[model samples]
Target: MPVLHALKRIGVLFLATAAILCTPGTPGAPAAADEPGWTAEPATGRAATARPYFYLEGTPGTVLEDRLALANTTDQERTVTLRGADAYNTAGGAFAVRPATESTGAGSWISFGAAGTVKVPPHTRAVVPFTATVPPASPPGDHPAAVVATEGGREVGVRVHLRVSGPTLAALTVEDVAVRGKGAGTVVAYTLVNRGNVALAPELALRAEGRFGEVPGRGARALPVELLPGQRVELTEPWPGAPVFDKVDLALTVTAPGGARATAAASAWFVPWAIAARTGAGLLALGAVALAALFLVRTRRARREPPPDGAPVPERAGQTAPEHELTGTSR
Candidate 1:
């Protein structure tokens, strides 16, 4: 009877271990590639989650409530700092979050119920409730933000997409354009500004013409910059093989998403000073020689031709004109 009881106990222990090993993990708690043990996500709230980002839409003066989930998959506890920041596209066109120290626009509007710092036990999640209040005079468009978590020098975040309800205006401007240098070593500089309430990936088309309507350099290229709302960036484009000696008319046409367009122009004179100086000197020398020849020709003609009726011809030192010639009478 002792042996039978021992065998039954052993079988029960084996079954219990097997069951524990076969259990599945919690849904949506999968670890990310960059952050192996930490993950931040949006929790259940008035906002809707479409995959990895949260979408919240409301009118001005409205308050939207949401929650952020910070999960720690490691065996040790992790202390993470939480904050909100505005989101924007990188130069490579990838979506990214702003720095923790900066909290403007949608980032400033977010308020959390818990402290800025939170600690989560091993294999547990910390839920933080947050509210985003839209200002009464907020512009209508998309305002992106994120709830970020930083732990042990590693940071993870979940995006918050806020759309204010009103008319959407997309405006942009190009200003302060100029052309510098000469010939093949020229540069076209300009300033691109976003005047509306949205981001822009601007496309540039450049055209340069000489004084005689000759196209010296023309091209269309896309800039690797993401201009944010109310932001301005000074950029330059290399213009090789530009005209060497002519008045150049440089025009830049910038276009972006949402039908934003602007055109700016600048004119510059590209003169080779060394060559111009040499040519001018040669012209002046030729003019001096031509004036000297004209003076000699007038002097010789006066000596050969007869004097006018009332004009008197002066006599030489030891010679005198004949009386018949002086009286203009035939001999």
Candidate 2:
């Protein structure tokens, strides 16, 4: 009972263990053995596109447990047989028929359903649960396998592969940082995004440019950088002025599990802000007024202009109004 209980997970699979390879089918699927009174319709089922597919969680390989679901998608009594199911090779995919390898081990971890059985009813769906096991010592990589079911004389089979991708680890992605600044003691800000799958402790070492309003001669400094998958962190560093440097470059480095590393960097423009000069305030105000005026003029024009015929209607871009009306479609 305990063994069976452990096997109930969504990732159950079965290994062939070089056992007596038994594949059955009927007349419809002649590819399968000749089973009498059994007519199989097309083995119709949707591939599980998300995790927990086939009721198994992690990447394939480690003796996952699951059952392929195939329903009678046609009228009249039809039998669906799974005979010689396996990963479709590149060549096989061209022909639309996959080549599958039988599994080898049942592993001692779990057992969710019966290893071998076949009998599908008309108008109903059948579940072919399977288990996958990654040899404890097996190297991490992609390994292929398949399951076979048979019904009728001809065979209607689906192809699936066993995956043996190695260890589970998180990944980190650092995005390019943007900065605006110039002059001494200027601070350039940047954002770091974590694109990996794992979480990371927020910490990083900083190294950035000192020329062109950059942190001059700056060494590594600690930045609080805790983040997780798809997370981001913003950082700003004060510029250290060096007479020899006109611009500064900001750089950061991060370390994670399995010796993985991530980095972000930014360049500080050397353009001196006019705000540092007395005329800077007046120039800033003038620029703002000009922008506001431009915005107002654009708005007034939009409001005053009218369509030639009826009220302007929203249409898909690139399509003319008459073309859209006639076709009842949008570009």
Candidate 3:
């Protein structure tokens, strides 16, 4: 009876081992590639408001508080370094941020605690609070900046659209309107200058009046630029419909959001100089021939006509007239 009891106990142990080996995995374990990467953005508010970028406004010599959220979804921990960076527009007018070392504007005003770094665990998120203290003499208007995060060789930036609270202006000007090339390859070039103390998203309209009538003109369209305060950008638009042989007066009207508008104009002649030059040469040749003919006719008339009174006459080779002979009297 004791031997039979031992055999039953061995069978139960074998079953229990098989069940444990067949189990898939523990609960709450991370699945493969479920959360692949990480992200950096503005932290959500207590009211659960999702923000695209950080917008902070304050008067001069004030401090504004904000928080940044860093999320890591991978299986390992992520170490990210944070820094403030000044924002500006590229030559082509694309928004960009300066490197952390070169930040001097609103970027320098931001503070990210004692150590500007955060370590996020796998499948976890971290919130870091920061402050931006405006300088006492900071200028009014938009002081664009960003919070930059770096890990390994990759960098991600979150925009901080900081603005100093004061009277703002959004004025701009269109300058140096010019037409280049000719015919099918014509292009209209101009420069946009932000005269006010605020950034501007300018819309441009191109109109032209040719000698005959209204020529091809461009309707109002938003330019691919964000003109920063006191910043100017030179841009060109292709005009495939420019006239082939007409003098045109081009007017460029640029408008911004804050009741800002400006107009600049230029005149261009699209003559086919090759054809004109050939025609001009032909006309000059005709003029020269006509002038020469007139000279020849005048010379012939002078030779055929009698000499004026009191003019001396030339003597023949064998005869001479007496000097004392009187006119209309026989001697």
Candidate 4:
């Protein structure tokens, strides 16, 4: 009976622990693979002032203060750890944050002071204040980052779009342009590098030319990418109507807001080599047959023709010309 009582108590404790542990499906949790039943976002003082992300701007050597809101939707108290992390575009161009240990740039400048960790009761929210102290030597422009909350190995991040007041530049380059496959399967692959201090939303235009004239190409369109400063993304554009039997010169023109523009070019020969090889072999075989037939006809004609009016006839392979006795007269 005592052992049964102990087992019941242990089961209750386990259930309580599970409820306290943050799992996905929390109100403020990022819609990631794991469901943590909590949410982290920019703190809005009043419900009407709901902000999606933190936006801070200041000059160098200035400190900017903001609040982050963490909501625990579970029926148990939730304990979470807070930290700052650098934000960047993944190679696939999705917004992501670096691990806290890898934080540099603006992320390193953020501090929560004494509120680095907090415990929130069931169905409660906590507002934590944080500050970003820009160093005097910090460069001017956008330094993206995020405030991350972790509970029981599950993490949620709230974006902080911070910018240091100063001159901003928007520039980008399209590199490594190449054409792949042929016909309906053609694709143009290239890399887009952000070379300036600002984020860019790039638009791409494709043009193709053959020896005769301009061919069909894609019209100017915006690419679904948000290129971060100093980051590059490799991408591909489909060319479903690629030529089948021509040498084509492909040019890609990419442009973005704030006067950002770039161009890259590549060349590809869209020849069906398999079909060409078959056709060439057939032609070669036909030529060989024609030549053999012509040779046979000429040989028969030469054998039927009389020796050119007393010209010396050539000796046969097995017989001499009878001791040269009137070889042309009787042969």
lDDT of every predicted structure (CA atoms): 0.68, 0.43, 0.74, 0.76
Say which prediction, candidate 1 or candidate 4, comes out ahead on TM-score.
4
lDDT by residue (tens digit), candidate 2, 164-192: 34463545655656554445655656555
TM-score of each: 0.58, 0.29, 0.71, 0.80
| Candidate with the larger lDDT of 1 and 4 | 4
Q: Candidate 4: misplaced stretches above 4 Å?
A: 1-36, 47-49, 308-331
Tens-digit per-residue lDDT, 125-154, candidate 4: 898988888889988877877777888787
lDDT of 1 by residue, 1-331 (tens): 0010011101111111100101011111223365467667766434833234555667888888766777788999989887777765443233456675666779777777566888889999777777888899988976867666677766665656677778766689998898877767788888888798765667899888788567656566667666666667778788886776888778889887778899998888888988999999999999999999999999999889988899987777989666643566776
- Which candidate model has the greater lDDT, 2 or 3? 3
User: What's the lDDT for candidate 1?
Assistant: 0.68
The local lDDT score (0 to 100) that residue 25 gets in candidate 2 is: 19
How does candidate 3 score on lDDT?
Answer: 0.74
Q: Is candidate 2 or candidate 4 better by lDDT?
A: 4
**Ten residues in sequence with the least summed lDDT for candidate 2:** 1-10
Model 3 ranges off by over 4 Å:
1-36, 272-331
Error of 3 at 179 (Å): 1.5
| Candidate 1, number of clashes | 0
